[model samples]
Target: MPPTDGPYDGPPAGDRVLALDLGTSSARALVLSADDASPVPGALARHKIAPTYGTGGSATIDLHAYVEGLLGCLDELQHNGHLDGITAIVLSSQWHSIVALDNDGGALTPLITWADTRSVEPRLDPAFDEHAFHARTGAWLHRLYWPRRIPWLLSEVSAVSFAGLPDLVIERLTGDRVTSVSIASGTGSLDLATGEYDAEALAIAGVKPDRLPAIVPSGWTGVLAASYARRWPGLVGVPVHPPTGDGAASNVGSGGYDESTAAVTVGTSAAVRVVHPIDQAPELPWELWRYRVDDQRAVTGMAFSAAGNLHAWLTNVLQLDEAHQEPTDVEIGSSRVIAIPFQAGTRPPETVPGGSGVYFGLSFDDDAADLLAASLQGASLEIDRGLRMLDTLFGRELEVVLGGGGIDASAWWRRCLTATFARPTDVCAEAEVGARGAAAVALGLAPVPGGEHLKPAAPEVERIELLRPRYTILRDLAVQAAQELTRYTSG
Candidate 1:
C-alpha cells in the first residue's frame, strides 16, 4: 500500500521520528531522519534490560526495573543530541508476557515473562475449551501466554488488572490506556474476526472489558501529553505509533511483508509468519495469527518456543571441560548422545514440546564438549522440524530469512541450521530484528521484501555451516517420543 505517514523531521518539529524498541533484552531507540526516513546522525541509544529470571518457580520481569531501563535509554538519547528532532516512538516485545496494574496504572504484580510456563493454568469461570478457544482466537490453549495468566490472577488476587507487557508499558508512556491491534492480535484474547476484544476471552480471562486498552492499527498518528513530557522530559507532543509485534517488524526489516514472502525467525524462540490474503485463512499445523499490517492483510505465524534454550542450557549452564569453551559439531557428532531439547513447553500438548535430549546414542566416551555439540545439533534439528511444519501448513516453499539469537552465535549451529533446513538461509547484518523492525514502523519504511535489500551479506563471514538432511530418520523417531512426552508432561 501507500505510505501511511510521512518522514516527519520538522522545521518547527525536526524531520525524524524517535522509534523506541522495548525488547526482552534491552530498550533501544532509532532516530529516523524525516528527510528520508533514515537513521539520523548521532548515538542510537540502548540500555540492557534488567534481568528478572526467576529460578525458584515463577519466572518474571521486575516491572519497575524494566521501566527504569526504558527510561535510562531514553535519557541517554536526550543527553545526546538525538532527542531534539525526535517525534514518535513505536514499541515491540516478546509475545505472551503478563503485567497486571491497579486502577491508578501502577503495576500490581511482577511482569510475567514469556518463559513462565509453570503448571499455572488458572480456571476460567466460563470454562473455555482449548480447541474452541484456539479456533476463535487462533492461539494455542497453552500455559506459555496471556490466556492462562489472566484467569490465574483474577481468581487468586482480588482487584488485580492485567495486560500483556507492551500494552502496560505503552499506556504508562503515552498517558493513553490503549493497545495496538498488531500488539493485541498476538494475545489469545483478541477476536481475529473483528480485531477487538473477544467476549468469550474477557469472560475466560476474568477481565473487565473497560480495563483493557483500546486497540489501534500500527503506524497510527497521535500526540504525546504534557504529563508524559514532564515524566520523560524528551516527550514534546510528538506523534506516537504502533510498530506491532517483534516478529512482524522483523518481516519488515528483512522485507518479508509481501503476500508471497515469509520470515523464518530464530530468536529466543522460533517462528514463521507469512502475511497472506485474509479472505483465505487456511488450516495450519502450527498456528495462524491475524496481523494488522495494512487494513485487510493477516499474517499467519507458526512458533516454536524452545529454539535457543537448548544452546543456552548447554553452553552456559552445562559447562563442558576446564577450557570453558563451547563445543564444536564434529566433536559432538562423534558422540552418540541424543537430546530431545524440549526445555520450554510447546504450543500444544500434541507433537509440540520436544523435551530433554533423549540419550539414544550415548557412549562411555562422551565428553562435555561432545555433549554440548550434540545439544546444539538437537536444537538445530528441531528448528528444521518447525520450518518443515511451516511449509506443510502454508503449502508453499518459503524463502527463509533468518534472524535473532538462535541463528547468530555458535557458528556450528548456524551452518547446521542451513544443512538441517536443506535450504540456503539469509542471516541479517544485525541480529536484533525486533528492534530494527520496531524502528522501521516509526520510519514508514518496509524491509526490502524477499531478502533482496540486505546488503551483500558476505558468505561464511558470519560462518554459516549448512547441515545436509542426513538425520531425517533420527528426527522421525524423536517426533514419536516428543508426542508421547507431551501427553505425559502437559498436566
Candidate 2:
C-alpha cells in the first residue's frame, strides 16, 4: 500500500476515531471522541469468532471468516451512523499469529494463533545459540514465534508469503502488505538494535525479505483502497494507522505507559508489561521478553500460557456451579491441596516441555471447591513469580494496574492475586481497554482515568508469605519430573 501524503492533522472538535480490537475470540469496533479519547455511547459493534482445534496441537481460525466478521462490525456501525465525522481508524490485534498467503494475497493456510503448540519441539540448526538469538530478537526460540512455526508449517504446506493476521486485515482494507514494528517485534525475527528483521533469524525460518510485509513505523498511516472505499463510502479518505499489538495497547489503556507502572492483564492467557524508552530499557532478561510498542517505546514482560483457560477447564471438570466458581469465603492458602497449574504447558524461565497440570496432596475429604481454590492459588503464584522478577529488574517496587475480562468477572481471583503480590493494585474500570488504547495511540493522548484501588490485607499477605516456599518446592519437583518424563519417553 502507498503512504498517505502527509501526517494527519489533529481531529477537529466533535470528530471521532473508529477503533477495532481483534482478539482471540471476538472482533469489536467502537467509536471514541477525539477530544478526550472516550468511547461514544451506543456506537459499538461486536462479532464472535471460534477457532478450530485439533488433536495434533493445532489451533486456527479461517482467514476469510475472521475478516468478514470484522467487516460485518463496520457494516453495523455504519448502519447506526457511527461512521459520521470519523477522522481515522486504528486497530489492536493479538500478537504472534501467522498466516501463509499465496501470490494473489489470498490465504493458503488458516491463521495459526499463539495457543497452537504444533511446533513445541521444533528442530533447529546445531549452530543456533538460543541466548544470542533472544538478545537480538527480544524473543525466545519458542513455538509461539515465527522461527519455529515457519519451518514447521513449510514442511506441511506450501506458500509464497507469510504475514500475521493483522497484516492480512490491513492489506484487505488498504491494498498494502505492511506491518508495524510493534507487531514485527513479537515475531522472533526483528532485531532490536536495527529496528528491522534480522537476516540470520530470517535465514533460520527459511524466508526471504521480499516474502514478508514491509516494516512500517507505529504512527504510519494509509488510506483505504478504492474497492474498500466504495464498500464503506463514509471512510473514503480516513487515515488508518498500522495495528498495535494488543498487549502494548492494553498497557497504554490501563495507565501503564512508563516504568513506574506495570500492567497485568488476564484474559484467555495472562501477561505483565512495563513500557520504557527503547534506548533506556534494561538489559534483556531470559525470563522476560521485550517487544516494541512503536519505534520509540518497548514493552518488557513475561506471559503465562494458562490463566482464565485453566480456570475454565478446572471448573468444568469439577462440575462447579456458578456459586462455587466464585467462592467468596475461601481463605487464601487455606486449602491442603497444592496444584502446579500448567494446563496449557509453560513459558519462559519456568518452561516445562509437554508439562501438564498436576494436583498434589488430594485426599478423600477434598471437594470441588477445595480443588478450584487450590488451582487459582497455583496460577496466582505463577504470576507472582514474574512480578518479583520485574521488581528486581527495576530495583524498586512498581505500581500494578490490573485489567481483562477474567479479573472483572472474579472477585475471588483478584483476592488471590493481591495476596500473592502483597502490594496495592489498581483495577481499570474501562471495559474496552484495547480499543481505547488504539485510539489513544492514533490521537497522541495520555492514559484515561483508572478505577478501584485494592490493598492487600495484612493477614492474607502473611499467609501467602508462608505458603510460597511450599509452592516453590512443589514447582521445582514438578519441573524435574516433567524433564525426566520427556527423556524417558523419547528414549
Candidate 3:
C-alpha cells in the first residue's frame, strides 16, 4: 500500500490531524493544527459512550458501541463541515483491554477490559517465572492485564479462536492485524528487552505464533476502512497512526516525555510517571513502562488505580451524607478523617479487586461532611505516597508536570493538590491532551510550511499552587496507613 502523505514535516495553518482518545467513560476526538499551542474548543469533539461493567470481573463493552460513537460524531462534525483541511487520524486507547474475534471479522467475545479481573489465577502459571517475565516484559503481573485474560479466552472459548485485542480492532478497521509498540508494551506479553511478545508468556497462553498483531512504530501507516469512513461522511481516507497509551500521551502532551520532566495525572486513576534509563529496567516495585511512540526514546511509568477515583468517592460522600452541595479546602483540616483508597487493583504484585475505602479515624464531634473533607486530604496524601515511590524508583524527587480530569476543573481539588505537593503543579490548559498529543504525533509527521516543520507546543504552566505540608502529622499518618496496607497485602 502506498503511504498516505500530507505533512511529514510541519503543516501550514488549518492543516489538521484528528486525534481520537478511547477512554473508559467516554470517547473524545480532537482536531489539532501545528499552528497553535492552546486548544480551540471549537476544533474539538466528544461523545459519551459508556462501557457496561460486570461486577464479576468481566468489564466488557460492545465493539460496535465504540465504533458507532466514533463514526457518528465524526459524521456530525463533517456534515457540519468541520473537517475541511484535516489530513490524518491518530488514536490513543486505554491499556489492557482485549477484544476477541473469529476469522470472519465477527466479535466472538466481550471487550475484556483493563477493569475486568475475571479469568485470573491466584498464583503465577508454572510456566511463568516472575523475575524472568519482568526481565522480558518490564511489566508487573496481575489478572487485569492481557497476560491472564488472553489465556482465559483460549481455554474458555474453545469454539471460537481469535487473536489478541489490538489485532482484532486493527484488523476490523484496516483488514490487517497490526499493533503499535506503544500499546503492545502495556500488555503483559511484550518483552521489554526486545520489544516483542515474550516467547515464554505466549507459549503458556496456548496462543498461536501468528495470533498476535505485528508490532510497528506508532506512526506507521495502515489502511483505514473506507466503508466506515463513508458512514462518517467526510472521514474517507483518514490516516490512522497509533499513539501510545493515554498515560504516555498525556505525559508527552504535558511535556513530560523526557527525563527532565515528570507528571502526576489524577483521573479515574492516579499515576506518577518518569522518564528513566530503559536499559537499566530497574526491578522496582512500581510498573516499568515503555514510552517510545517511535524508536527514538523510551520511559518508565507507575500507575495508581486510586488517584482520581478516590476523590470521586469523596465527592459522593460530600453530596449524600454531609449536606455540602460543594466541597471546600477549609473543610479539610476541620474534617480530620482518613480514607483508605483501594478502589481498583493495586498496580503491582497484585491486580485483584477488593480494596475499597476504609475510614481510619473519626469522632462524634466530626460531621459526615467533615470526614468527607478529611478523606480528600488523605487522598492527596496518598498521591504523595505514590509520588514518593515513583521518586524512589527513579532514585530522585522528580519535577512535577501535572494534568488530568480531576484538576482540570474543580477549584477545590486544585487547591488540595497545590497544598499537598509543596510544589506548584503545572496544569496543561489544553483539556484533552491525550488526543491532542496524538494529533501532535500526526503534526510531527506532517509536512511543514516553507519546507520547515513545527513542534508540539511545549506545555505551558497555566497555574501553580505550592502545597507545602501544613500538617506533617496528617501526611505522615497517611503514609503509615499506606505502608500498613502494603505490608498486609505483601504478607
Candidate 4:
C-alpha cells in the first residue's frame, strides 16, 4: 500500500476511478474521487514526453520510452495507494499519431508522431480530390494525417499494420487491438458519415482496411491483460474503457457538451472547438475540421500550429524567467509591433511552407517586453478570427470554456482571450482536462466536470477596444506573408 496523505477519513475506496492522459510530451495519471468529483490529493503523477528529434522536423518516440513513461505513472499511483480504491481505468491520448506494427504485433518503427513532417512529398493519386477528401474525412490533406504518412511508410518500412497511440497503449494494457471511433476519426482515413474506413482514402494511400484496428465506441470497456494483471495485482480485473482522442476528452472535460459553449484549448498548439449533436453535418468553412466525439456528437474546430510553442520561442529570445508569465502591467495594443505568430507555419486555412514570422511596426524605442506583448496579442487576434468564423458557421456566438495546460496556468493568457473576443472566459480548474474527461466517460458523467470560470477584468476592456485597427493591420500582414511563402515554396 502507498503512503497515506494523513489520518484522513473520506468516502470509501470504491468511489474512485483512475484516469490516464497520454499527451505529446508526457503522460499523467490521477485518481478522481467520485464522491467530490475532484482528483485525490497527492495522487497526480506525470512523466516527461521525451521524444527523439532528428533533422527536417522529425520527432519520434521510442516505444520503450513511451511504455516506461506510462509505467512510471502507474508505479507512482501504486506507491501512493491510488490503485486500491479505483474502480476503473480510463484513457485519453494525443490524436493524429501512427505506430507501425509487425506481423506479431511488435513495434517495427518508432511511433511516427503528429509532429513528423517527412511525408510532405508522398505520391498522391491524381484521381483523389483534396477538397472532397476533406469533406468526407473532415480532415485536411496534410502531412499530419494518415493519407500522406501511410503511403510513405509502405515505401520505406516493412510493416504489416499501424495503429494510433491510444489503441497501441490499450493493446499493451488489455491485449486488445481496437480503436475508439473518436480516435479513428482523426486518422484521416475514416469517413465521418459512415464511421468506417473510407474506401477511396485507403485506395489513395495504398492501405488495406485490415491494416487498421477495429473501431468501437469510445465508452467500450474491457479488462486488463494477463501480463499486466500479474505485474499489478490491484488492477487485475479493473474495467478499462476504450481510449479516445485527447481533444474530444477535453471538450467533455471542460463542459462543452452542447452548442451553447465552446472549448478553447491552448497547449503546445491551440484550437477553438464546439461540440454539437450530429444534425446532418453543418456547412463548415473550408478551414475547419469536423470530428466525432462519439456516435452522436460532432466536434468542429480550427487548430493553430502556434500557441505555447510561440510563447516558448519568444521567451528564449526575450530571456524571460517564465515563458507564459505576463510582464509587469503592460497595456494591450500599446506596443508598436505586431507578430505573425506563425514561426511553425499556419495549420488551418492552409499549410504553408517557409511561412516565416513577421514583426511589423517595430521601432528602435521598443524593448523585449513590448515585443513579447505584441506577439501574444497577435496570437489572440488569430484566435479571435477563428471564434468569429465558428460563430458564422454555428449561426450564433457561443460562450467559451477555456481549459488546457497553457490557459490553466497563466492569468495573462486567459485575460488576452477574454479581452480579444469581448466575451466571458472561464478558466477550467482541471489542468488535466484530458484525464478528467476520460474518467468522466468511464463513470458516465453527462457533462463531464469543468473547473472555475474567470471573468474578464475591466481594465483590459479599454486596451482591447484600442486593438481593432491593429487587428486589421495584423490580418493583412499575415495574409501577405502566407502568400509570399506560398510563391517561394512553389518556385
Residue 320, candidate 1: C-alpha displacement in angstroms: 7.0
Give the lDDT of residue 107 in candidate 2.
81
Q: Which stretches of candidate 3 lie over 4 Å from their true place?
A: 1-14, 36-38, 122-128, 159-169, 232-234, 276-292, 317-326, 329-334, 445-491
Tell me how many residue pairs clash in candidate 2: 1
Q: What is the lDDT of residue 376 in candidate 1?
A: 66
Q: Which one wins on lDDT?
A: 2
User: TM-score of model 1 relative to the true fold?
Assistant: 0.81
Q: Please give, for residues 1-491, the per-residue lDDT of candidate 1 as tens digits.
A: 12234434432334566766667666677666543334565657777765565554467778877777777777777777567756566666666677777777677788877666553555555655766667667676566546666766665555456677777666666666667776776667777667788887776566767877677654455566566576556666666675467777766665566655567677666777776655666754434444444335567766666666566666667654535545653532334566555566455534344233464567777776777766666666666565666677677776667666666655566665565555666666555566566656555556542322223223422322332233555656666776776678755
Ranking by lDDT: 2, 4, 1, 3
Q: What global local distance difference test value does model 3 have?
A: 0.60
The lDDT per prediction is: 0.62, 0.84, 0.60, 0.77
Instruction: State each candidate's clash count.
Output: 23, 1, 16, 4
Candidate 4 Cα lDDT to native: 0.77
Q: Model 4: per-residue lDDT, tens digit, 169-197?
A: 88878777888778888888889888888
Badly placed stretches (over 4 Å) of model 1 are 1-15, 32-42, 50-57, 118-132, 228-235, 286-295, 318-336, 349-359, 449-491
* TM-scores for the candidates: 0.81, 0.95, 0.82, 0.91
Q: After superposition, how far is residue 457 of candidate 3 from its true place, in Å?
A: 29
Cα distance off (Å), candidate 4, residue 108: 2.5
Best of the two (2, 3) by TM-score: 2
Residue range 143-239, candidate 3, lDDT tens digits: 6556676777766664244444445555666676677677777777777666677786676555754766678764466656766655554556656
Q: After superposing candidate 4, which stretches have Cα over 4 Å from the reference? A: 1-14, 35-37, 120-127, 322-324, 447-459, 482-490
Best by TM-score: 2
